[model samples]
Target chain A: MSVDAKERPLTPATEPFAEPLAELDRQRARALQMGGAEKLAKRKAEGTLNARERLDHLLDAGTFKESGLLARSARPEARAKTPADGKVAGFGKIDGRWVGIVSNDFTVMGASSAAINGKKMKHIKDVSTQRGMPLVFLGESTGARMPDRMGAIGRSILGQDRYEYRRMRETPWVTAQLGDCYGSSTWYACMADYVVMRKGATMAVASSRVTSLAISQPVDKEDLGGWKLHTAISGLVDVAVDTDQQALDLAKKFLSYLPSHSNQAPPTYPVPEGSDEPIKDILKLVPESRTQVYDMRRVIKTIADKDSVFELKPGFGRAVVTALARLDGRTVGFIGNNPMFKGGAVDPDGCAKVTGFLVLCDSFNIPIVMLVDVPGFLIGIEGERRGAPGKIINWMNALALCTVPKISVILRKSYGQAYLNMGGGRNSDEVALWPTADLGFMDPRTGVNVVYGIREEDDPALFKQKVEELSRDTSAWDLAVLYEAQEVLDPRDTRQYLIDMIEVHRLRMTNCVGEHLMRTWPTSFG
Target chain B: MAEVKVASEITGSVWKIVANIGDKVVEEDTLIILESMKMEIPILAPEAGTVKEIRVKEGEPISEGDVAVILEK
Candidate 1:
């Protein structure tokens, strides 16, 4: 101000535009510094990237076009302290695709929420939605600003936007928890389609200080909302990584599997080398004997494109495996039962996992491939206590509403009501079966005991006869005879069968888009 | 060294005891096999350790979270 004004001479009549433009430059420079060099260096010393630096790392070089560069606090008293109002929002490209981004600035006032920054967030959301681009939120905040949020005026300011939490699935929303995330950060993370968190980051409704005060007991931050708790118990986070850069990289990778918006098909990559190789290894991975258990994930890897399987909620529901993968370079969702845990029985948690995955695939127009090896829904008082029936029905309801191509492969066991939920019968567009597929109402031994009131040990001869009687017409050929299975495949041909069938069933008339039936499904349930 | 208690992930009866005391086992090694719903589910060691105690016998009923073996890591 001094150099420009003194050199130009302060004369309103002589130079009318000089003063205002100089002031603008000064304010812009102030905003660019972002809580001064000392605070940024402190963050650097702590091995953390500041908000702008994170944006640079996440976005393509020279692609960040900032939206609220001149924005500060709306409150006159706090104007000087709040630059960009604690949030940096802009339009950027992630892997050459346009995406709206909001990165919270923790150095300034803990990146707290206030009136002006809320407007910036709303603007980004509006433009991203209207322009048909995905939204990425790099979340790390200390929650709502205090004193500014106290009193009747604060009550009026809070929750003015009614559609803040409404997720219509118009665009793929991706979020990252890079540090302590609370309030808006946690809310957006919960509503996202894919959420990745740093290993040490914590995400909760409020900071531990307020939580401990409210509960009247000391609380450990990690225990309250850590990576293990969410990934293993809560199922809120899709993946947890070791560093901030890893979280951002995962966010980019997740978006790679989805479209920029629900109206378009996901981008495809070139088919990887060796994709045409036979999956003869699948024969050895799945045991022919129905009673034995094997790792279903190995079967999934053998079927999908090489190194393209990205698993989601891997720790929460041990019985089911949901992942995003590519077949012949096109995106598809895999819902497979894992016999390694709980005998591949769908529990309440597993039901919720499948339901959410179905919603995502349907909303984004990705085809689904279900690898059926489920014994049945786990039955017990514990399952009943967790509302297992409602969750199972919810999964069925979402699957029925889906309009995209669904292909089912009955690898081994597909029994009881779980058969319908796992893409059996009219539930899927195409059904393939291996010769080893075991289709029945229940396990033969258990059914015989329930009907005849005799253990296999007591009447071995009768048990064998009864088991054979019950197992009649339940083989892969039997299903094929009834025209239920489109094809009876050799275990080796499973991968090529899925690829050709997906191409045949691709929604050509609709431009490879689905009906978006489950667009309004709730984002969080586990 | 740490003492890790290996627990059953499901409620089942012990069908077979494959590991004995003083035997060294690696992660995912089958220490005991449990049978439920006509499926033999192996209770695997979560980490590499020496088996210090086998607490459940074959055909004994065990509930979920019931520790079946104590491993010295």
Candidate 2:
């Protein structure tokens, strides 16, 4: 302020722009510092990756192209304290395929949602959608920025983006719940096609503090939206892991099974060793007796490429196993009835899980391979209250509308409406059966009692005769004789059979792309 | 010591009780077998524990989520 215009020294005719550029360096250094060294060290000691480190672990090495490193809070007073506006967002190569990412930096103002970060999120989402790339969200937030969102100005900006929550299955969306997730974080995770949560993470509408105040009672944070609630009860999360690395690895693995966008075929990998080998162990895993229970996951693993089975919602719907795996190097969705739980009967959660998997596979041009061994649907008061009927029809509806190739293999018991839902009749492109396959409206012993009023206790011999008669024409051989199933195979030949059938049913006319009839189906139904 | 209540995951009649009171068990060891949909479904120990109580008898019908056994670990 001491120097007047006349007293100030004249600038050099040619300035190197060194001072201004140094200020640019200072600004970038401040953004990179990210809530300062102490907070970042505390985060490191807490055994979780920082925001930038998460991006490095998630994306291919040296491929992250950050979008808004200079972005700060919209409020002038808060600008100095905000870094990346609490959100680190950009585009990066995941396994050499481009994906847009948003990683919440908890070191910076709790990574809260505010005007600048919202714009940054919208920008990444828009570019990812418009340019055909998968989008990922690494979520950990403390709801909206306080005071900035507490007034008329906040109300005006709250829902200004109409398409904020509108999900179009244009490209795959994946999310990871890394810590306390509330508000937008929870919504994004809920709407994500695939979500993975760290075991200790919590995701909910509002944090327990607000929730407790609203309900006038103390609320346990974990009970509100912990991994157990999401993975085992609500079916909101696909998998729960012990750490952030596992969650990010799972995200990469999941993206490997999907295409960049709905209009293209999923990328294929080199077929793993032993993929074409006979699955002799499958015979050992499945019991020959119709009433014996076995783990269908073993059968699916033997049929898929070696080390290729990645299961989704494994804990929630124990009756059904939905997995993304590789068959002869190409991506395939495997829906199998797990006989180890509920005697392989479908339940409401199972129905919803299968329906969601069907939508994902069909939308992304991945063919489906269903391993059928279901007895029937589980009927009970709980199922009725959970809208089991609607969920069942929703599964059927998605299956009928799906344009991707769907092949089915009947392992043992395929009965009642579960038969059609598991890809019997005209539901699948090709159906095969093992010698153990039993096609029936119901179990023969149960059918005898329901139809002929025959009980083994009352008339043992007549009941046995009636059961035998009821089961007479329900064998795999009968189905083969009637041309209902395309072929009957020894259980060991299942791996090769599925690979051959998938080759036969490839969408040659459409350049390996499906019609994507289920593209607009809801991301989750339960 | 922690008490764990083992519940039946399915509605079925208890076919057999494999673990007796005070028996030491490991995780995933089948403690009871229930027959439903004409298939034998084993209710396995959720964790390593000593069986403290067997709450049902053979052939007794039980609903899903009903506590079938209690274990102390």
Candidate 3:
């Protein structure tokens, strides 16, 4: 490694570091290159993809051009060791659109950030922002390097970069929580526009080790920062997937729905081959029996353009479903209830999930389709303890504020306050119900009990007779008679109905904003 | 004692009242709500209730949980 001493100024130069820095850069790159390969093999053995591999999956083939390839720590002792500071920074294209990327390799000193690595990150961020390219961070790190960032020198490294520090609305940023994402990874994820996490990955403000020592309590990885906790309770992450490949695919799919940068509209892609599926089969997808639970996901996949239902928070909030799917190759947000869990009743987590999704959809001008089959909010002591009522209200508030085209389809039961929350009445622009929909404040059986205090067991004949009488007035026909729902149609017509509704509102208003709540929603906790 | 009248939010028939005369109650506690379509409606206490009288029997049809009356002190 050649050190150009002549270019080294006695005082720190305000200008960019010169070729004297090249020796440090080369050493860092070599260190990372050597450590990265070993680490990659080890990770592959464990059935996980390394950060760089995940980045490759995210970008177009052969399009990556890395920057700061040789950057390393400026500290004399640290500079003599630790190359590339275990981070690979670069720019690449995903489907022809430019994106800046950085993937931390945990094998090199545990992928800890050093002075030069920080500078490299800041530089990449600056370039991406200035050029209006999306920034993607494949984060898998152990926070800052202790040796490099421990004293005054470390504090200097910690000093903020004036150019990239300001989060002016310039470009979109994405972060993938691949593995143990701590410190800088956590920070970047929190600040990103979109964040995707692998199912088994851990993301925390600090690693379990640091947290355990500091707090004097042992913490498990999942307990410290699990996918379920973030997606369900915190609402910090946007999506959690089963595999690294899914995470990468989601990153690509998410970017497809977003513009290359804030100033431009999301690039529209030609509908992929066989993307359109017949709408006729959608009816059979939903079972005829209300008591029988069917996979709502199948219903979503059928309605959306084939292969376009990119689900977010799929494992969390099992009751409420949210996804960004393409309809005729245009991105829209779809929120529905899954009867598979708690009979499609919205619990606190489900409510929070839908609330965030609604905010994102409204902010991004993504039209919404709410498929209703709610049996009201989940009721129980557990529900109360979770502050279910508050979350439900929050959901309602978000729904009320949304100005984009909103459509509602009553798939089955639309009971109680849940009816209003699911875009019933005037909550949506178009409200349609399936023929099987039973709209009422409560089910007939429950209604009979509340009114008469009669157990059928007490007087079976009378109780049966009374239930029959109450059922007469509580059907979909009753709701339609009062104009509560506009139309009740066969389930087969849902696709055509939604397509026509979207077309009607396509030009109704212009949504040109660069950032939506989904993009701005925090990906990490403090 | 104040009168504890259980009114249903929606018009439905009572399924059953788990509470009876002289049953102590708390706020928002479910006395009984009538079931109409397929929902388990809870008729909660307007105030804590001590069953003063049972207005209607289990088999009779009633709107809301107005079948039993309670007194609160």
Q: Which candidate gets the maximum TM-score versus the true structure?
A: 2
User: Using alpha carbons, what is the TM-score of model 2?
Assistant: 0.95
Model 2, residue pairs in steric clash: none
Candidate 3 TM-score over all chains jointly: 0.74
Per-model CA lDDT versus the true structure: 0.90, 0.91, 0.73
Q: Which of the two candidates, 1 or 3, achieves a greater DockQ against the reference?
A: 1
Worst 10 residues of 1 chain A by lDDT: A1-10
Higher-TM-score candidate of 1 and 2: 2
Candidate 1 per-residue lDDT over residues A1-526, each given as its tens digit: 1122234544553577877777776777788788879999998998888999889899998788888888998888888988899999999999999999999999888889988899999989888877899999999999998878989988989999998888899999999998999999999999999999998889999988899999999999999999888987898998899888888888999999999999999999988898666486778788888778888887888899988888888877878999999999999999999988888998999999999999999999999999999999999999999999999999999999999999999999999999999999999999999999989888888888888886889989999999888888789999999999989999999999999999999999999999998899899878
DockQ score of each predicted structure, in the order shown: 0.69, 0.79, 0.03
Q: Which tens-of-lDDT digit does each residue in B1-73 have in candidate 1?
A: 8999999878999999999999999988999989976888888887799999999999999998899999999
Runs in model 2 lying further than 4 Å from the true structure:
A1-15, B20-27, B47-52, B71-73
TM for every model, in the order presented, reads 0.93, 0.95, 0.74
What DockQ results for candidate 3? 0.03
Indicate the residue-level lDDT of A411 in model 3.
89
* Residue-by-residue lDDT tens digits, candidate 3, A1-526: 1233345543344546645465554454465463646666888898887756776788888787877656666766665445566788888899888898898877777778777788789888888988989889888889988877888867876766765445554676788888898988988887775789898899998889899999998989898898878775666788788898998887877888876665554565566666546566776677776655556778888888878887877756677798888877777789988765545777777887788677656655678999888878877677788888887887887788776788999988888999999999888888887878887677667777888998878888888887788767656678788887777777777877888888787633344442343344433221
| Top candidate, metric lDDT | 2
> Which segments of model 3 are wrong by more than 4 Å?
A1-53, A126-132, A147-172, A190-194, A198-200, A215-223, A226-246, A261-265, A270-278, A459-474, A481-483, A507-526, B1-73
